[model samples]
Target: MKVKAIRVHKIGGPEVLTWEEVEIGEPSEGEIRIKNKAIGVNYVDIYYRTGLHQEPLPFVPGKEAVGVVSAVGPGVTGIEVGDVVGYADTPMGTYTEEQIIPATLAIPIPPSVDHITAASVLLKGMTTYVLVKQAFKIQAGHTVLVHAAAGGVGSLLCQWANALGATVIGTVSTQEKAIQAAEDGCHHVIIYTEEDFVAQVAEITSRKGVHVVYDAVGKDTFKGSMECLMPRGCMISYGQCSGRPDPVPVSDLASKSLILGRPGMRHYTATRDELLHAAGEVFAGVAAGVLRVRVNHVYPLHEAARAHADLEARRTSGSVVLLPAMPAADS
Candidate 1:
């Protein structure tokens, strides 16, 4: 079968994302060929397109997707043809209508969920899953501050943190986004553009700062996020959407006995077992309604450029996905 995919031929602007027809090959041993229904578009995709997280050029440019298995190769014991599966991985080929995925990375998608939601949660949802469940082990009554409260990671973080009984202080750039963040699970939404987040957190916590700060905004919010934390509190810098934060002086951590971390989904889900474990929690979170995946916008597979443009300009408020093609068959 022929598949249409968005490829980045050169490293530069969104215009570099080109739609091209490619041949779909059979899965090799231990692999499954998937007919992708939904492909996720996230801020990380923008970083790849702009050469921020450098990759070998002229390849497919996405890491998350959900689809039905069209075929399975030998030695793949856990998966079979016709299974609903999804993955978030390093190959960066999920932008295609169909892809050959290693069975190790493919997790069975429960029938309770739809493809769009599955794709939306695969990476970001899993990140939040690991962050709350493993990274800092959020507990009841802990106070947390989440930067970019309406972005992909931020939205998921708010929901998971609140469900874990943490009081969430989410920071957003505008009133509309602040409202959206509150709807997601933020106990308190701070419009960082209009007010000072550090002062707000200080007031909200009655001078006893939060236990942790989930900061993906990086350069713009790092210092402020750190200040919002209590003594020995953790600051998890997982992404650089606002550009990478500058180097910190180690002396800074000494004053607070701070626990600084830079966690990545890749690190959290490095082994197949870890991937399955995290995917299971993510899947259960979605199925149980404890977590919500919001697709704020979707673009045709060929419109990846416009999609990247929208995300980079901060026009998108929640998770975004790319519909590779209309679903042709149900699994």
Candidate 2:
């Protein structure tokens, strides 16, 4: 079948994201074909578009989407045709109208969760689940500092950490984002554009600092994030949105008795069971109102380039999703 998709012929800017028709063959053994309803837009996609994260040329640059199973491959059981499913773990090629993915990676979306919500939260929420619950357990009374708290994953992290009975301190660029962060369950919000986040964190924590510092902004916040952590506290550096952080010196950790981890979803969801467990927790959180999935921007699938530009420019907040069913519009 020929389906519309955004293909990257070369790694460069958002303009490199080209919308074209591509052929998709039938699902092979242990694979399933999905007709995407909603596709997620994330910084990782931007990494793929540029040369930051290397991938083969002329490939689709999306890792997350929610869709319905159009066909099931031979020997695939438990997942049937017409099941509403979402996937974050991948073989790439998700920026399309339909995709063929491994059945093991396809997670069945609950009836209560809509396709938009699933696309918006599956990847981000699962990341938060592993970061707050698995990477560094956020116990009650713990204090956590989340950089980019108004961002897609950061917003969810703030809420989930707060729900765990931890004190959530978030850093955002604008006052508007500061307000949004507070509403998203942040106990304290720091406007990093005007204030020194490291100093603010110190003041908030009474000069002691937090139990854990989740720094996804990478290069820009890496050094400061270390300063915001208490002795023996963990620094979870999962992303490099600002740019890859400088290599940490072993002596630095020794000096502060600090722990640093750069974890990825692959490690957290190494098995199908682990993937389901993390995704299930995220879905449950959304259903129980413990976490809110916000879709702040929506675009037609072909407008992915514009979406990427907005994201890279920091013009968007909350989650952004692409509607594959909608027709492409002029830029």
Candidate 3:
């Protein structure tokens, strides 16, 4: 049978995202065919589309999606047909009406969580989980700085860290985003375009500096965010929306015994067990009201090109998900 999906033929602008029909054969052993309900649009997709990340061209480029099992192929038993599921796994084919995903990667969604919310949360929520729960382990009395506080991962990170009893300090480019970040439980916000976040962090921490800095803004905020960290503090440069962070001098690392490096949700949840554990924490947080998802935009799957345009143009405020041609009725 055939399915509709967004395909990128060559590296370029958002114009590269094209919706086309492609054949989808029955799933192989250990795989399951899914009828997509909703799909998440992440900044990483833009990086891939523009050749910044350099994936194979003429590809379907999406990582997170929510759907229902239409057919479970041979050797799959746990997830039966009609089961709702979501995933943050690879293969980059979620921008579609249907997909064949590995059974190992899909996680069953609870009845309380709708497909759109599940799709929206899978990638961003897991990123936040790894940032707070895995990397630095945000705990009581810790002050943390999150760059791009109004963006998808930042919005959730602020609230999650706050719930963990840490004071959340967010950096945003605009006054509106600053307000949004503040409202999302951020204890403080730095308008990075106007003020030096390093200075603000120093003032906020009484010159002691924060315990950790969660930086995804890359080149633009790397130096400043690092400067705001205390001795032996950890700096996680997880994403490079502004551009990849440059090499840091070994002397700088040794000078303050600073801990800094880049990491991703892929490594953090590499194994199926790890993925399940991370998803469990995320769902629990959402169920308990500790984490609130911010879905700011939803475009039809065919309009994925426009979605990418908005994301790359910095015209989006929060999470954006692409809805399938026929959205499922919440059950």
Q: Which candidate has the top score in lDDT?
A: 2
Q: In every candidate, how many clashes are there?
A: 0, 0, 0
Error of 1 at 59 (Å): 1.3
- Residues 1-331, candidate 2, lDDT per residue (tens digit)? 7999999998789999999999999999999999999999889998888889888888998999999999999999999999999999477878999999999999989999999999999999999999999999999999999999999999999999999999999999999899999999999999999999988999989999899999989999999999988999999998899999998888999877999999898799989999999999999999999999889999999999999999999988999999998755789
| TM-score against truth, every candidate | 0.95, 0.98, 0.96
For candidate 3, what is the TM-score? Answer: 0.96
In candidate 2, stretches whose alpha carbon ends up further than 4 angstroms from where it belongs are: 327-331
Could you tell me the lDDT of residue 313 within candidate 2?
A: 92
How high a TM-score does candidate 1 get? 0.95
Lowest summed lDDT across 10 adjacent residues in model 2 is found at 321-330
Whole-structure CA lDDT of model 3: 0.89
Q: Write the per-residue lDDT of candidate 3 for residues 35-76, one digit (tens) a residue.
A: 999999999988889998877778899999999899988999
Residue pairs clashing in model 2 are: none
Best-matching candidate per TM-score: 2
Summarize candidate 1's per-residue lDDT along 184-294 as a digit string, tens digits: 999999998899999999999998999999988889989888888899899998888889998999889998899999988888888989888899998888878888888
Candidate 3 backbone overlaps, count: 0
